[model samples]
Target chain A: MEAALPESARGGVAKPSSEADARRRRAFIYGLIAFLLVASLPFLPVNNYIIAAVVRALIFISLGQAWNVVAGIGGLLSLGHGVFLGIGCYTTGILFNQYGIPPWLGVWVGAVLSLLVALVMGSMTLRMRGVFFALATVAASLAMVQISRHFVDLTGGADGLALKFFGNSWWAAQSRTPAPFLYASLAFVTLYYWITRWILNSKLGLEMQAVRDDEVAAAAAGVAVFRTKMLGLLVSAAMTALAAGLYMQFYMAIDPEAAFGLSQAIQLQLPALIGGLGTAWGPIIGGAVMIFLSEVTNWGGTKIGVSGVDILVYGLMLLVVVLYAPKGIVGSVLRNAMKGADR
Target chain B: MNAPAVALEVRNIARNFGGVVALRDVTFSVREGEVVGLIGPNGAGKSTLFEIVSGNIRPSGGRVAYFGRDCTTMASHLRRRAGMCRTFQKVRLFESMTVRQNISVAASQCLPKGRDLGEEVNNILAQMRLEHQAERRPSELTLADRKRVEIGRAIAGHCRLLMLDESLSGLTHDEAEHLIDEIMQLNRARGITVIVVEHVLSVLAAMVQRLVVLHNATVIADGTPSEVAHDPVVIEAYLGTKQKALR
Candidate 1:
């Protein structure tokens, strides 16, 4: 027997759940359309420069979204995320270059190592609130950078580690063109976005948001505060580590300065912070916007024959955003939409 | 008549901050389904005692048991799972969430798995008379409504022992009385044990069956409202030499 659709057919106003369902449907359609466009980019005869920019944007979204699980949702802002990235890059690069292992298996080893580091770091630092935790993570990241530089034999020291490239070898996860890397990065971004949304809707997400709002109150309401923070840290660490393999594959090399430096650490937070800290789409939008702005500015600077001019403009734009739109682009939009709903 | 089982027992609880004593040898037990008032002047260790009982802080010396099980060293969240819930002197609500989400967070954690969480949240909304303000954030609601949401969140869980810490301080006289009625109904209708800490004597007296008074960091009186009201020690502790001077 066919079941009848449940709504009264006469009423125009929808229930909250129905409204949410409609929104979800609209979002899925939009996402599908957007995915198709991105997937068709490499075939549209676009320049490699543009394709490479999009690829960098996707990696930022993937990494930033993972960091958001810890800093935004779990309310534990960590400044040492670069250590996990470095660990993955170094671990995968070392395993593959020295031991003749494939990066496909090597990334998992990096994930395990990152997990161990996160467990140790989270236990000691998650108890510290706000700036102190950030400081601790910064110290840890600096220590990892020094460690990477000091190990000349394993990491190639200042010069960094490079993969033994066999051009367009699928087994080596190497590619000569940006197209394959773009597709891989696209898949990574897509998986990251879906996983983020799933986590936001899960029970763990509820507990994490609770702790983020008020830890004492969350505890009073029966949430394990420390455990929740640790879980968030672990998940963030493993995911960041997982994405590092692709980063190494795309770049073909990873130096300590590029992998574990403060600049790289700050880069990780930009997408989520500028998009909408805890929202799933925040990083995706922020990543795309940032990459587009950077590419345009960089190209303009080259035309003007001036170096570092783009950086000054980028800083100015970011400063404006931090001062005026403290909630980030997506977060401000959401807040305004909520206000309209109330009205 | 059968006696009610003891739901919470505190024995010889003491706390000291450096050289200053906050509480000294304070002991009390709440019977199941009974409403008790914890009254004390400022600096009389009421807050400290509440913290110890709620597992926010450990007493320098003493024991706390919940429903015949020792919970002296249990984490605050674990204690909550064992049916111990508390509110803050200043309302501690999730400011980012709607009133519905605030209560739903607790209900989701405390309710048995497979139960309809949406139905449970709706029931709590109805029970607390928060249906109209369910979609409003704590910052958007009135002070009374915020207090109601705090209480609602505390009791939404598997709460057998509900402790409210000065939850009615800032409300208007009518609002306080109405909240008192709802709190009493929670005890009488829902059969939950309650311990309320309030500075307002008339309000607390009306809602509670018995009062435990703290003075000079120790229990000075424990009796019915009328009995405690007449006790000379409680009178002296609260009023001191200024009792006749102010009048």
Candidate 2:
């Protein structure tokens, strides 16, 4: 602890900032290495199940990154992120299935629609306390599920809408193999990661964090508190919509259960919650860990012949992480590492 | 000699919570580059007036003007960006951010376009002599250091007028003196207008050019510290009337 003190505090000259810069550079290198290792997975001659699972992992990673922007960075804890995803999935699937619009263009339309939903939602709930905000989001999520089921003609009700096959076309965004989705998910994850990082470093990000810590202080510091929170929610929703569009393209199907379900809501948050909230790499690592854990636990559950054992593991994992490593695995590790460096 | 320009004006400001009046018909103006003190006893509405002037809370009536610009309807953030900054009576630093980051948060927002924010942050860190503790968070610092960081944040950019609400509270005598020195340096060297609210009249009298004494939501006296201190009405309201009950 004494070593952590600056030399100037001990009557010596102040140390230069080179040490902080070096730590940042090192962390960047490690993140790059992790990204490369994941990028290499599709090249291996793996079975379709394995490939499909990795694609699913990548999809969740993208969702988690999007969620992190609002919930973690902006401090607006949300449980209804799936509502945006639902909007995207339904918008893209319905447009393409009925009007023959290409998925690529439909995705952008979905993004705009999702942003509008976020604008309304944020206005309604951003001023609420954290738990109240979360509950409001949960209500929104459930409402979206009901809306999906109610609109049978547009959303296909509980039966769902599957995109008409167009063979392998970039315009349709459809692929016979999961390989394309694996790569597409890779692109989405990478894009969301960079976007999250950009936001975290930008002036808006600083103000958002300040607002999160203390609204009065942030207002005093020249931050427009409500505007900052709304902007974060809009960005997060738009990104979630884009990822949902890709999910529609990959699965060729959309259903109320999959789009706005409790399972998906938890899935969307677990990556950031487990990896590290408010960090670009958190979802990347967290999503991978979540998928890996699910696979292992699923296999174990089957051997034990228990019901819903996989979900039980998830709850247990969340409890432990919240208790012992509230910063999540990556956050705790990096914090400790920084503390060590300080010493 | 030309009279100094009015840096801030509060006219007939009034506020009430339920039936209780917080401030009533309060009015004052601060001159550019002058250091003024707002001394009052408890529940005198000094903090409420500070909030109204800083744009954090709206006044029930009247107006607040900055450099003759009516800003009563403006948001607090816009007030800060327009060169009006303030500190809280209760210290309110961003808890998760390090001291440097807290200062930089304000610097990044309030600095003029094209000014290097990092340079301004470094300059403030040096000016506040907080370089040694720049990486530490608010919780890690002592009360004096936390106050320094908060003030450092308030002055991080192009500050024209500063309002400090009980900024000297919760400090030892030596610590309070050191903090006062920092505030004095900011006013003397940078020509920034200052309005400070304090309970310690002795300390404030020495530090400020003028004092506005508030008692029961209205100004009882506004004059040089010496004049206000000797005013009998001020003594009756602020120092208490020594009229004893007849046995």
* Best model number under lDDT: 2
RMSD per candidate (Å) reads: 4.4, 5.2
Worst 10 residues of 1 chain A by lDDT: A5-14
Against the correct fold, how does model 1 do in TM-score? 0.94
Please report, in order, the local distance difference test score of every candidate based on alpha carbons: 0.83, 0.84
How well is each residue in A89-135 modelled by candidate 1, as lDDT tens digits? 99999999999899999999999999999999888977766687788
Best by TM-score: 1
Q: Which stretches of candidate 1 lie over 4 Å from their true place?
A: A1-23, A309-314, A334-343, B239-247
lDDT of 2 by residue, A85-202 (tens): 9899889999999998998999999999999988888888776555877888899899988888998999999998888998988888888888888888989988898888666656
The alpha-carbon deviation from the true structure for residue A202 of candidate 1, after best TM-score superposition, in angstroms, is 0.9
DockQ of 2: 0.38
| Native-to-model Cα distance after best TM-score fit, residue A221 in candidate 2, in Å | 1.3
Off by over 4 Å in 2: A1-26, A124-136, A338-343, B241-247
